[model samples]
Structure formats: structure tokens, C-alpha cells
Target: MKFTKLTSSVLAGATLLSIMAPTASFAATSKAGSADAKTNDNGGTKLPQNDHTEVGISFGDNNSNGNTGYLRLQAVPHTLDFGNHKLLDDSKLDFTADGKNTSLSVNNTKGSFNGTNANQTTTLATGTDTALDTVKGTAWATVVDKQVTRIDPMNGPEDTSDPTNPKPTSGFHKGTDSVAGTWTLSVQATSPLTAVDNGDPSKEIVDENGAKEEIKDAKLTFSDTQYAQTQNVLGLTKDKNDNTYAKDLADLTKQPTVAPVKEITKNVSTPLVANGSDITVAKAAAGEGQGANVFGWLPENIKLTMPAGAAVSNAIYKANLTWTLNSTVA
Candidate 1:
């Protein structure tokens, strides 16, 4: 019985050893690296990056809305006043206005460097001052004396005649181009000016001598005149001054004073301020730097054309002007 018991115990012990050996082997492999072990990694790798952008532009009354550029325009004296004056017979008076006396200024900081357009222009128009007695025509007229000539300040003597020699107005019209473009300044009168006594064209007026007399048919005119700044590129040649003073005022009769006189045309007369004529006042080309005092004036002149026997009146006569500024890229 004892021998059988011993044999049974030995076989059981051997079976237990076999199970323990397998467990120990698994524990050792999990805790340490094996030279025979091979790693197969199947995966993807990534890298990073950045981006880009830009903006746009425009011009006008409102310029603060995120645009890339802008332009601004203004008239110095909002109102231009030609004070009261007494009209005399036979004797002619020289009446003119320009940047020195009457001025229009332009201020531009435009950053639109896209085109070759570096040009700007200013113009004028006139209207009847009163609505009381409607006159048949404009109260004022401009005429450049045909026989006169513009005297260059840098060259010589000023013409001493009425509607004196055309010259640059004192320090009035001036401009500077930060961008690239040309600027043209122009003017016109578009008012129907009429003379009347208590609004009646046939009323009589008391003269300085206290004589009540009929007002003669007066002539008002704008002399067709043009003047230009001397341009001397490369100091190559003599600077040519504007010779408009030497030219004749377009015959008011030939060039009807009822239409705008913009450009000089053969029979197309530049009418009174009532007619919208694009009169050239000043100009600045690209690269001309800042132009100062480029000037032109529409001198209004009145003449008693009717014979000495017209009836006159004792009343205040007035006229109004509508000056316009037109701009374009050249």
C-alpha cells in the first residue's frame, strides 16, 4: 500500500512542474527584449504650412470705408461777392477776377497710382442774381480785348489798357500731384443778367449829376482769352509764354454769347455765363511738381452801346455766378 502511494505522489509532482515551467517562460519574455523579435510598423506622418491675401480702392464725397485710396475738393470762399458799383457812361472800366482776386483751389492726396491720368480741371457758370424782375439776358458779360496781349511777369511791362494784359493771378490757383495725372482748370458764366428800374427794363435812372435818363442798351461780354504756363523741358529751348493777350476776343456777334464757350470753334460763339463754356483757366502736367499761382480771369466788362438818348433808372442791379469744377483723368 505504501509503495503505490509513493508512485502516485511522484507522478502528480511531475505534472505540476510542467505547468510552472511554461508560466515562468511567458513572464520572462514579457519583461525583457529578445534579439529575435521584429517590429512591423504600418503608419502615416504629417507636416504643416501657411496662407496669403490683398485689398481694393475708389474715390468721391465719402472716402472712409476701408478703400485703399481717396480724393477731396473744396472752394475757399464759399461765396464770392462783387461789391456794389456805379455804372458811368462813355468811360470804360476794367473788371476782372482771378485766383488773386477770386480763387478756386484743389487739394488732392489721391493714391491711385494705376493709370497715366494726371489731369484735373475747374470751370465756372453764372446766373441772374434776382428772381424779382426776370431779365431777358445775363447781367454780366466777359470779353478779352482782341488787340491786347498778356504780359509775362518774368518777361516785361503789363498792358495798361482796360481789361489789362492777361497775367497769372497772385498766388491763387495752385496744386500738387502725388499720383500720376494732368490737371486742367477751367471756368464759365451761366447767368441771365438784366438791368431794370424796379424790375422794369424801361425805367429811368438818376445819374450822379441827378439827371433822370433812360438806360442805354448796354453790352456785356467775356473776351475769348487763353493763357498758359511756360514749359521748358530739359532747359532745351526758350520758354514760350501764352500769347492770348495778343489775340482778339472772339467777336461776340460772330460767336453767339448764348452758348458755353469751351474750346475755341470757328463760328461757335462762347455765350455769356448762361452758356456753359469750358474756359481753360490753368493746367499742370505730370512731373510738373507743385504748381503755384497758375492764373486766368474772366473780366466782366459793360459798355453803353445805344446812342446817348436812352432812358435810365435809379435802382440796384445785381447778378449771380454758378462756377463749376469738372475733373477727369488724362
Candidate 2:
């Protein structure tokens, strides 16, 4: 499940107008003389007028003047469906799978244009079980979530969202400031894989002879692999001595990586930090647009090792994974 909320405040600022001076008019009349008589008279003064009385602008949390800033994160592959695993008995059995097989992604949006922290730290927490399991179903393993060490983002050349480009999504401009800052994300699985028998109506695990059983001796571990597009693409380049200038979004060296795989157990918190990742996910210059999507694929490696004396249930197994992305930086 996902939840989100944002707080916005309009920093109404004062607008100043320099007052202008009043205009004056005068006419002079001189007494009649023999040949060179003249007359002059003076009229009062007229005050200057202004059309506007108030001058104010709105701003956000960052160095924004009459602009807005925001941070957003969304889970990719909303559901991690590890499909179809066969049952094994007595001897230990194992199954290994990848996250990419399920199509995983984490979409993020950060900007200092309106807020100061263009960079955010993301963390994951395990949550509830799925509908396929009983209310008090026992988890198959002590640990469930794991990740590899942080890896560079697949910093392919800036794309024009062209179908011909590898992993194409969007493009970066030459003058706009790409989203600058480092952000990290973590993934978590709250429950264990439970096998529901094909004959049982409650979706409970069953023995060969047909007795309900809970396979608590099974261990499920998670892993990940990071990849980048390496074909004909446009990349952002920068001067090594200068930080303020870049050729385009592809010019920046934003990269993301998967940290070493972690072993997740029930009730034990396994925190996966983005150790060496950068903004290669997507690049944005100021005012290019809102929420430019930087798309990348994550291949998850899942291994299920069953202990000896495990039940032999010939049915499909299922589990729930909760991927949480936090903005709290440590």
C-alpha cells in the first residue's frame, strides 16, 4: 500500500513602488506698458497618480521567488508477483528468481526550485500480509528482504523519448539546471511465502496426504542487479573543474546501484542504504517540465531454501512485498 501528503505555504512578499513627485503649472501676467507690456498667471499643482497600490509575490521553502518546489516518490512494479513454485518434500528444495522478472521500478521527483532539499533519503519498511493467506499464517522464513550494494544508475545518454534509443524516456536541455542532489531508496518484504493447497478452500498449505501444515522451515531471500543502456545515446558532459556548467542532462554523472543483498528476517529491520547511487535515473533542467520520468529496470534475485523435513505440498506459493521510499536523510 502507498500513502502521500504534501504541505504548501505561500510566502506572500511585499511589493514596493517609489512615489513620484507632483506636477505643477504656472502662468504669469505683466502690467500693460507703452510698447513691451506682458501678463503672467499661475495655476495650482496637480498630484501624480498610481494604478496599483499593492505589490506582492509568492515563494516556497527554497530559494524560490514566485515559484514552487516539491519531492515525490512512487513504487514501481506495484505488485511483486513471484509466480508458480512447485512443492517438494523431505529433502531440501530451492528456488531462485530475479526482480526484473517482475518488472521493478522506483519513480522519484526532487527539486530545490521551491524546496531546499533537492536530495532525499529513502528507506523501506515491511507491512501487512496478502489476502491469499490466513489471518495468523506462519511465515516461511526468518528473513525476507535483501539488496546488493549501491550501483551507478544506468546513465544512458539523454533520450528524446525516442523509440530508437535504449531505455528511452525523456530528454534534458542545454541551459536548464538538471535536478541536482543525491537520493536513495530501500525495499522491504513484510511477510513470508505461504503455500496454499489446490484442494483446500482456505488457501492453506497441505501435506501429501491432505493435512494442513505451515512450512515455517522455509527461508526466502531477496537480491537485485543494476543495469544501464549502453548504445547510441546522448549523455550529459561537464567540465571537471567547473560544477555550475554541463552540456545537458546526459552530461551529469548520475548513477544508481544495488547494494549487496541483505537477508531479511521477521521482526528484524534490514535497512538497505543507497551507498554509491546518483541522479542518473532522470535529469531535469529548471522549467523544462514537471515530473519528468527517469525510467530504469531492477532485476530482483529471489532464492527460497527449504529445510529438511519440509512439507510436500503440490500447490502454488505466494507472498507480499512492501517497498517503502523515505525522504529522511541520515
Using lDDT as the measure, which candidate wins? 2
Q: Could you give candidate 1's per-residue lDDT for residues 129-231 as a string of tens digits? A: 2221121121221121111111223444554455755654433124422232244444554543334365452453456896643233322333433322211
TM-scores for all predictions: 0.27, 0.30
Q: What is the C-alpha lDDT of each candidate?
A: 0.29, 0.30
lDDT per residue (tens digit) for residues 1-330 in model 2: 122222212212211122343556874432232223231221222223236688877321112122112322322333223333323434425443321112111211112111223311111211232221221111111111111111234435655666676463333222222332223334454444555655552375656898644455455454332222111111111112112222332343553232321211212222212221221222222222122122222212444455666555545455444443333223
Runs in model 2 lying further than 4 Å from the true structure: 1-71, 78-86, 89-92, 98-179, 196-213, 227-300
Off by over 4 Å in 1: 1-73, 76-87, 93-180, 195-271, 289-312
Distance from true location, Cα of 136 in model 2, Å: 39
Candidate 1 global lDDT:
0.29
- Candidate 1 backbone overlaps, count: 63
